[model samples]
Target: MEKVKESEAIEIDIPLETSLKKKLQQTPRWETFEPFALSRVPYIIRENNKELYEPKVVSIGPYHRGKESLRAMEEHKPRCLIDFLGRNPEIQIEVYVEEVKKLEARARRCYCETINLNTNEFVEMLLLDGCFILDLFFKVRAREPHTLLDVGWGAKTIIADLLLLENQIPFFVVEKLHAIVTHYEGDRDSLLYLLQPSSVSPDLPAKGNIYHLLHLYYQWFVPGRTSKQRSRRYSGILISTEHSRSNPIVSWLNSRSSRSNKKPYKPMRAIPCATELREAGVIFKRKESPSDVFDITFENGVMEIPMLPIDSIRRIIYMNFAAFERSNSAMEHDLMSYVALMDSLINSNRDVIILQQCGIINNMLLNEEELAVFFNQLGDWSTLDSDKHYFAWLFAEVELYCDSRWHKYRAKLMRDYFNNPWSALSVIAAVILLIFAAVQAVYSMYPYVHH
Candidate 1:
């Protein structure tokens, strides 16, 4: 209907390597649990450097969540869009729009508009200023939308797949449940959705089309769609929009599962491999949960894997090409120490390891601060599979190690002060002797003290 003049689209095509393809392959064994891997079967072995274009990659270190989040909002201009949508409620948007408005008004809103998809021209303004939108989808009162379209940079597909499974699609709200599509530009973490109001008749003629959605992805979602080879490519296979205009909306009278026909893809589950990079020894289980780095359990004295060492794998864990080239040894050391500690705990037998400035030797002796640090860093550890749990634990461990080392260093200074009390007495005696000597010298010179 209406287009934001500021937006420009870029297409990216990521060619999957042979190894990456195999890595993405679905092992028929656990297909029921992880289905997205199967649906991605179509593009399993894509070409390398598949052309991709979108907003630049955004970085939010675990330490700087609040400040980075606020900065992202200010840079992304969510407030302007929220205000715009609020005033023009009749403008016809996707379900996501309503969520944004509610959150923008909240003091502590969780959900937010992460990027402005419609406003391409203004995208640069937002990006250059270093702002972002908070994900405010939680405020909306709707069944999470099943289908999702992701148009962001760098491994965003992971987040997108997770969202879809969570039953939350990113869409703007034109009306209470009506989603409108203005213009088609390339996808870049920006999105628009056609809404389906529950109160509306299910038998209505204007439901959305699965094929049209597919075409939209081929057209706008993929980064570099144009460069694909004819025989090797999946371009221009669908009927043109002109052909489908006779009935722009398909009926959802009998709604099907978004993943109805497609099966889930599974990689090998809990395939442990021994890694000996340093004193850091890991029995990494490759195919566990997507979020997990290892897949071993720990209960009582029965650990699924042996504990790893922190000092052993410091080099690889701390080596970030960018940071390394820049010669940030301090940061490198911190990161290395942090990762090592995490690696150790992931394989440890302790069920509740408290990460503190004092390296946790005994899980039984953890204090509140140590527990809080561990829990806070590994926010939902209990819910994770062993792989994720261990990975999180390892990361948290490194941070704790650094803290513990600092604490120990400070403690040593205190211990030294208390250990040698005689040193303080010696200093006092010297001061008293100096005062007496000064008085005697004054008396001898002036003869007032002798009288």
Candidate 2:
């Protein structure tokens, strides 16, 4: 009656392997196909620059495809797809669908987001996006006037949307469609021609390689920037803790070249902008290099910035590139770092003018203040990476030159005595006249001595 004791009952403990087996048997969602290549802009980035991150005109990829605002462009997609298909009257659209079906899994894996689409739906999406992109490149490379080109802002909007990071199909999908449709291996060349059209002939990947459109662009913009993989997919947001915590660009100027880790970083005053540097006798020169556009350098009292062709798409592409870096844990924010460097150089309208006169800034925007604000507001930067010296060294050298009393005095002397071309000529004429007067006075003294 003390009750059939509970101790008499049998205890059944579940085996750990059995639990694991159950978990293993559970249905896997798009997880089995998680891709390391493409991802939407992480919210932290998208939150601050939503306008830039969102597609304004067209959406080529799944990320921004269904937005209400982008609906108008969706109507154009069928037209683009039709034009792309019409180029080869013999090839049915099913041939393109089968090709995309083959790439569907690979393309799906390239996107970090779980594309909740059936194989048929996914393949169709890829084909439509891929054909639209190829059609755009074809129109750009055609060199003949199409009615679309004549349509105001038609060509411009297409070009801009193609550069948006969110608006990209997998490159392999695009390339395969290009080959099947165009009947040649000219996809890469056509894209390079359309994007650069002048100097760049990017050594694009062989068929199966490139990640997406932005990846294609960074390769052209920096030529070898993505030549090597910088981090594993596991690394997560490659920007350093210090960079996010404090503006390292500002920290480096404030820092006193710490030789040891134990030393506390001392913050120095921010370096002067283009105008201030000029007033302190610093020279601004355009660096002509086929290397990275942001390969800024300082030497012999001159700050040489590579000439950046200020174009409409440059801002859009750069914003996407920086966002891509922010989303990936393995990649460094080199694009963001570059923007911070530009921001440091431009503090006001006057600074933009300084760069413009020096041929460093091609102000296609024509509004110096607006351009200055654009650079200033790029990516919510507080400073730059203190440990990294993408431009820290240049800033330090500039700071040293500006701090020199001798440089300041000489700068003042040059400005006061010989600033303009006319001023220099007048000074030379005055010196020659004074020398003649001195000679005449000496001759008069000699004649008096002879008498």
Candidate 3:
């Protein structure tokens, strides 16, 4: 029998093809799609320390709105609402609800995930959460005591929860609710004033530009230098891609020769730890009244770093800030850069002690080892671009200072001979004895010559 001819190849499924085409057409274009400001902490970062990302006591946004563990704080939200409403008695509850309802779509778009709550539910959630936050701010500003917020550890936990990457509603929602409730006519004073501490200027980003509470908090720590200035500073260091790739052998040879010829003043992948740097004659000092925590500087063998107080709550706050920067590419990695710098400087307990003695670190951890571990682990959460980060110049200067051979010799001499008064005295005595012996030998030679 003739080999059975295979049935004609199956024709493409017209309906299925059409369906797929429709799906492809509906899919968002990656080039044009903007990222949501509020998103889950990336798994790469969250896996390192899940507790830092999760809200322990309260949930503000739709992501963690109904969790069983966070529900205990839900009942307290209504109490906050009552307190908020009591602040502005003339404005009815419906006015606030209506305002938030208008903001529902915009607020939902701020979150990366699709919100499951309906219009009514979403509006009410926004109302309660926004009012709760504003009430806390009011309480904090007035220095008034709240039954829950004033209770032991409650304020700290709630503040951390509010700053969580997952637990945030859009700031505009809160701002709108505030305006409706308070009828404040001032341009900058109402919400911005309340959110920031007295020390931070209320002159923040324009109202429409702010994403959420965490974003606002992130803005407060931004380095005084503008991005344009940073770009200018890094402009000279950028090698032309065409020139680098023009000749492989020549490029390799040039790189080798450059390495051999230079004094190694380049940026380091990881700078020496505090102890090692100290041994290299690098002095550490606490930057007094720094503009912000990121204001670190190095000059003439001295590194002035702002004081960093490490505690459980502050660690969580900073970690969340780092996580936010990691997730949102639009944000500058100021906090992450700072963390990376700290991680490089603190490699062990001895390094911690060095920073502590210089008043650079006020570690509240059980031991110096724990603080060191915290920084080391945090460094793993985000990869820093040393050449492009805020601390790039500072790092380069520090490495250049450490690379000085004279500084090393001087440091060695001080450590070996002048480390203590006894050592210094012995050194002085030995030098004097050698000088006397040389003088006596010269006199004896003179007598022989005269004879």
| Models ranked on lDDT | 3, 2, 1
Per-model lDDT: 0.27, 0.68, 0.76
Per-residue lDDT of model 2, residues 1-451, tens digit only: 3344543442235667887888878645556664555767667757877877677777887888688987877787788888889999999988888778888777877776667888987887888788877777677676655555677977766666777767788877877887887686655765545445345544443233467777766655653333433221111323232332344444443453354333454333357777878888888899886445765666667778887766556666666766666666555556666676687778988898889998887878758877886676565633346445344444545655776799999888788878998988998999999999999999989978999
Return the lDDT, model 2, position 150. Answer: 70
Candidate 2 C-alpha RMSD relative to the actual structure: 9.8
| Tens digits of per-residue lDDT for model 1, 140-161 | 2223322221223322332222
Tens-digit lDDT string for candidate 3 (1-451): 2333332222333467787899899654545333555789877767768899899998898888889998889999999999999998998888887778888767766666667789999999888888999999999989898987778899889998899888888877887877777777445456787888665544434333677888788777564345223221221344332232233223333464487895323345668888899899988999974436766667678888888878998788877777777887766576777877888898888999999999999999789988988887666657666566666656655655676799999999999999999999999999999999999999989978999
Error of 3 at 127 (Å): 0.8
Q: 248 in model 2: Cα distance from truth in Å? A: 19
Error of 1 at 29 (Å): 12
Q: Which regions of candidate 3 deviate over 4 angstroms? A: 1-35, 198-208, 227-260, 263-266, 449-451
Cα-based TM-score, every candidate: 0.20, 0.72, 0.84
| Model 1: lDDT to the true structure | 0.27
Q: What is the lDDT of residue 210 in candidate 2?
A: 60
